[model samples]
Target: MQQLLLQMLDGTVTSLKVFVLTLIFSLPLGFIVAKGRMSRNFLLRGIVNLYIQIMRGTPLILQLIFVYFAPYYVIGFSYDRFTAVIVAFVLNYSAYFAEIYRSGLQSIEKGQYEACKVLGFSKTHTFFFIILPQVVKRILPSLGNEVVTLVKDTALAQTIGVSELFRVAQNAASRMFSTMPIFVAGVFYFIMNYIVSKMFDFFEKKLSYYR
Candidate 1:
């Protein structure tokens, strides 16, 4: 029983690691991709859109397998399971976030940009000062959804031997020949997602003045 508790704790830590790593990497990459998709350069925009489509179209489990194992099979290099999980997750979620950012940016009125230009603001200044807040406000709900999904998606990391929550639960269930640990894992996920939803709700309300 004590061993089960320890394993569960370890699994929870791993899940948290994956979640944090994915968010850290994906958020900035998503912004870059969103900008690329919005670029006036035809080639850049096409390339960004193509990348987003491929990531979004595929299953994350497949992507995790490819990231974690295919490298060794193809090129004789192996990555740690945690690293592979983080990379796959960041890439997959970044694509979705890129679309969210694109939608938010597009929702802004063109007149705002023109006004910024007329005020003699540089592109960078205009984007940072004038456009970013509105884009962030618009995308907060979508971002919250992605965060909630990420809580569940972390379970996919177990397929690559990362020993996250679901994997730990599976081991526990097999040992006990019961499903209690599985239910416990579900509770962990539910609580994590609930906390994320509340945090986002608070932020959304704080940003309501922008509405």
Candidate 2:
């Protein structure tokens, strides 16, 4: 049991690494995608919209497989499995986040833009100072949902043969011929998601002053 716990701890570290890195990359990339989707340039908007459609419309496992294998097939080069998993995760989640951001940005009334314009605020200043705060408040719930989903989705790295927690549990289960390892893995996932939920709750309360 101690051995199993140790193995699981190692696996959890991998899972957490994937989760954290995905969030770190995807959050900023999502904002960039959102901006592109909302751009005044029709071609840029169209391209970004198409990318979002492909990402959101497809199964993430498929994306993972493609990301992992495409370089070898298309470019005759290989990527580390973990790197591919991170790439797949970031690309897939960014699309969802982009839509979330787009909705939040669109929710702000045009009058707010006008108000900022009349105050001699530059577009950059208006966005960073005036627009973004309200968008964050409005999108908090949806963003939390996506973040929670990301916790579970990290398990999908197993599909690409990255030894995340679920894969570790499966390996142990197969060797032991018992379901206990799977149950233990479930506990890990539940605890992680619980922490994520509480963190989001804290932020929601902190930002409630916006109301």
Candidate 3:
């Protein structure tokens, strides 16, 4: 059992890496996406819309396989498995996060923009200082839900053979001919999700002052 735990722990590191890297890249990319989605240029908006549609429409496992294999199939090249997993996860979640941000962005009233203008706030200042904080508060719950889903979605990295936690558990379970390792993995996931939930709740309370 101790050895099994050590193996699982190693796998947890990989899973955690995927989770952290995806969020780091995806959150910023999602903001870019939201901006483009609301762009004045028709062509840019169309392209971003198409990307969001494709990413949100497909199953993540399929995206993982495509990301891993497309380079080899189309360009006669391929990177490492982990890179593919990260790319796929980042792109997929970025689209969802973009929509979440869009909804929050849209929810802000025109009066706020006018008020900021009267206060001599630059557009960037208005967005960053006044508009964005409120948007963050409004979107925290939806963002938290997506974040919890991301915890589970990291398992899809295994579809591209990245050996994340679920993959490690499957290997251990098959070797031992027992489901114990699998169940233990579920505990690991639950703990992660619980922590995420608590963190979001804390953030929500911190921003409750906005209301």
Cα lDDT tens digits for candidate 3, 1-211: 9999999999999999999999999999999999999999999999999999999888989999999999899999989999999999999999999999999999999999999999899999999999999999999999999999999999888887889899999999999999999999999999999999999999999988747
Backbone clashes for every candidate come to 0, 0, 0
| Per-model TM-score on C-alpha atoms | 0.95, 0.98, 0.98
Give the per-residue lDDT digits (tens) of candidate 1, residues 100-187. 9999999999999999989999999999889999998999999999999998999999888889989999999998999999998888
Report model 3's TM-score to 2 decimal places: 0.98
Compare the candidates by TM-score and give the number of the best one.
Answer: 3
User: How do the residues 1-211 of candidate 2 rate in per-residue lDDT, one tens digit apiece?
Assistant: 9999999999999999999999999999999999999999999999999999999999999999999998899989997999999999999999999999999999999999999999999999999999999999999999999999999999999998999999999999999999999999999999999999999999999998747
Which residues of candidate 2, in runs, are more than 4 Å off?
A: none
Predictions ranked by TM-score, top down? 3, 2, 1
Q: What is the lDDT of residue 57 in candidate 1?
A: 90
Model 1 lDDT on a 0 to 1 scale: 0.91
Candidate numbers sorted by lDDT from highest down: 2, 3, 1
User: Please, what is the whole-model Cα lDDT of each candidate in the order they appear?
Assistant: 0.91, 0.96, 0.95
